[model samples]
Target: MDSEDLAESVLIHLDVETLIPGTLKHEKCEISTTRKCYSYIKKRTFATFVASKRVSSSPTDTSPVWQCCDETFSDPSSVHKHVSNLHAEEIEQLTTAALDQMLSQSEEAFQKQEDPNESQSDDPASWIPSTSHLSEEELSKGPGEVLLYYSYCQIRDPKLICSWQSELCSRLHLTGKVRVATEGINGTVGGTKTATKLYIKAMLSHPIFKIMQVEDFKTSEGGAECFSELKVGVYKEIVPMGVDPDTISYRLAGTHLEPEQFHKEVQSLLEDASSKNDTILLDCRNFYESKIGQFKNCLAPDIRKFSYFPDYVEKNLDLFRDKKVLMYCTGGIRCERGSAYLRSKNVCKEVYQLKGGIHKYLEQFPEGFYRGKLFVFDDRYAISFNKDIISDCSYCGAPWDQYQLCSTDFCCQLVLSCSSCRQKGLTACCPVCQAKEQRSSSSPSPGRPHREECECTDSRPRIPNDTL
Candidate 1:
């Protein structure tokens, strides 16, 4: 059968829902098979059409004017039905043009597919946009770039949010991790600039994230293949502060201090002798994160993880009983819950947090009070804001801030190692891990070495052996 006849037969076998232009319910539609067919055909046709028009000299001549209407249907049958019923004239025109071109290029197209040496064009229009799933502006942003962003808000159903986010991220070719919880969503995704921007727009458009703005997103530039894969999951809490979301309410948390206000507060506390004694600048990040970079005189807890924050707070509760506690974290989500936890315990006279946290603080005041490198969770690992090097090399006593993973097969701990020490093959975080690596390397088996116990538990790379 001909292309038009085949399209009609497919449409006849499939069910299409007719609805008002703006009243389609995306959640109710299940168009798995039809969507696959639509995507495949759309890509093939658009690619061939763009290739055929690549020789046009005029800018307008090269641009293909698509006549598809604004209203989208995920199912191919639904799209065909919509075109046949509402846009009969346009469908007939497209069908005729597309079929004619397909027939003329049949030989060349088959040859191109078979020839391994033939490279595909890098033009934007060569690949069809998933317009049914994204906006025109989003599609115009193109691909092959990356961005980073996060959000915190109330989420009623974390699992449901996870499912939706997973689907959206997958469709957009995004990677990175997302944590959904009752309190909100905490995510760090890396994708094409277009995909990431659309993800943020779609998120802000959702009812749950209506309060969020574009400025709330913290972005970073990277290649399109920054992250290895995407991971969207549901958790008890986004930041894992070990506090009940119901008990410690973020709405009643500490007062938010902007970058300038926070800087002034820090300066005033340092200059004012009397108030300096009463005020406490607390670092609400993990020991590893704060060890390299922190505000001078800030009381950063020497804990392993955020889960240990509660115990540290309980032990130091007496110290904050009459003091004004000022807390800050990497992004501010942790501080929201951390400050709330402290206030709920009635341990401080007043509570305050740095709005947007260290990330924003550095953006505003690159040469501010904060010193040393700021630890991050991405592949870049750490970033330096100032010349201060607070951390020392794990193997050697020389000052260093660069972090490297333990050289062992299984241990994933991070350690500060100077260039000199790294050159000396002292890569393991601890002696135990070093021994493990040595044993694995000396083993006879060529495949992945057998698992061995190493004392390296967390990201911190303190020496496990007493002598070391």
Candidate 2:
């Protein structure tokens, strides 16, 4: 047999039950003491008996010889029997003693290492993740949360806050997007319950965020997995209203109405059909957002992005003229600046905003005027308050509010697709996008399908003066 094959046979026959004494030698922590001992003995025994028998300096020798306890054996079976009968139990006992000593020493070393750290004062800077010891599976199964919040207060250095947020999020093992601007900070982070709680506590302790209370954060079920990655950066605008913050300040935003007050106003509008003629319930979010969950009898714009809201308002100036507008967004951040922009036009009679937006409204009244799932920016896409669905699949006529990013390579449009269509692989947002994707697949190129913007992603006029 070949030398490699002989080595394998010897390893199979070697007695691995007995461990080497820890006092004999040091090995890597990853290598168990018992396994290390067995390895050492197997190497020595195999080299001396097996290798010497088959591969020898003097080509005349072919008999196996195993030496142990001042005696020798010519046959492999005899040597194995002798070791099993005479040495196995004694070796096992010795190894057990060595393991006990090693464990005790390890414990003592660990205590000595921890003593100095324990004596020091507890600081958040030195905080360690509590789930560091948990397995990936355990972390996934554990209770977690996603915090959606925004603060509109002036900051001297937004870059400093941005850097701090990046480091803080990394340390806490959080995953989500955080936009820090000179005006304020807006973020939606997801992590373990402990981590999210710690994040809220840290924010509260910061002087810049003193105006924010626990109520400012709208929390929902889900964890770090809800977000693909952690992105903390500085931006010119917190909510991207596409207007110069210097020109349209949130300080000039419309009057804020509490959830109850806003509910009453909405109920009054819904009860009286003629009241809606003079008063407008404007949804400040994008078409996709309001399409899934919106207040009854509200006007949801067909704008694709938040940046398009200003243009929409500019184009439809007559719609808001002499009308009382009630604006609301996902978490109230958009309405802060959106209302300011609308009021700036001086066309609207009065502009009021939902203090905490749909988030707070649902918290106080889950079965209130708002129906269906609340659209979110995270991987969750949407969180439901009631089973009511107000949107239909873009592909089919079936009612479905769940939004999935268009599968077209470069298209960013979110398509409302029912489970049946999705299962059939109808992921493209529109017919043009689906045709483009198909053409790219059958092309001569061999990489990911080349993609370009389609009509589905382009700007569109506002929806008809009707609530769908």
Q: Compared with the true structure, what per-residue lDDT tens digits does model 2 show for residues 324-348?
A: 8999999999998899899788788
Clashing pairs in 1: none
**CA RMSD (A), model 1:** 23.6
Q: Which of the numbered candidates is closest to the native, going by highest lDDT? A: 2
Q: Which stretches of candidate 2 lie over 4 Å from their true place?
A: 1-141, 442-453, 462-468
lDDT of 1 by residue, 1-468 (tens): 454764544333322222111122343432222222232333334333223223334546634332234553433455544444554443334434443444354545445542211222233122223447666555434554444445556555666678778877776777888888876788888766877766777777665665577877776665336566788899887878777777776654677789999999999988887887779999988888998899988988777678777777777677787689889988888887788788777656678899888988988887998998877777767776678898899887898888877777766678787899878878887887777666776433557554433454644432211110
Off by over 4 Å in 1: 1-152, 442-468
Q: Estimate each model's TM-score.
A: 0.65, 0.68
In order, the Cα lDDT scores of the candidates are: 0.66, 0.75
Top candidate when judged by TM-score against the true structure: 2
* Residue 213, model 1: Cα distance from true site in angstroms: 0.6
Model 2 deviation from the true structure expressed as Cα RMSD, one decimal place: 30.7
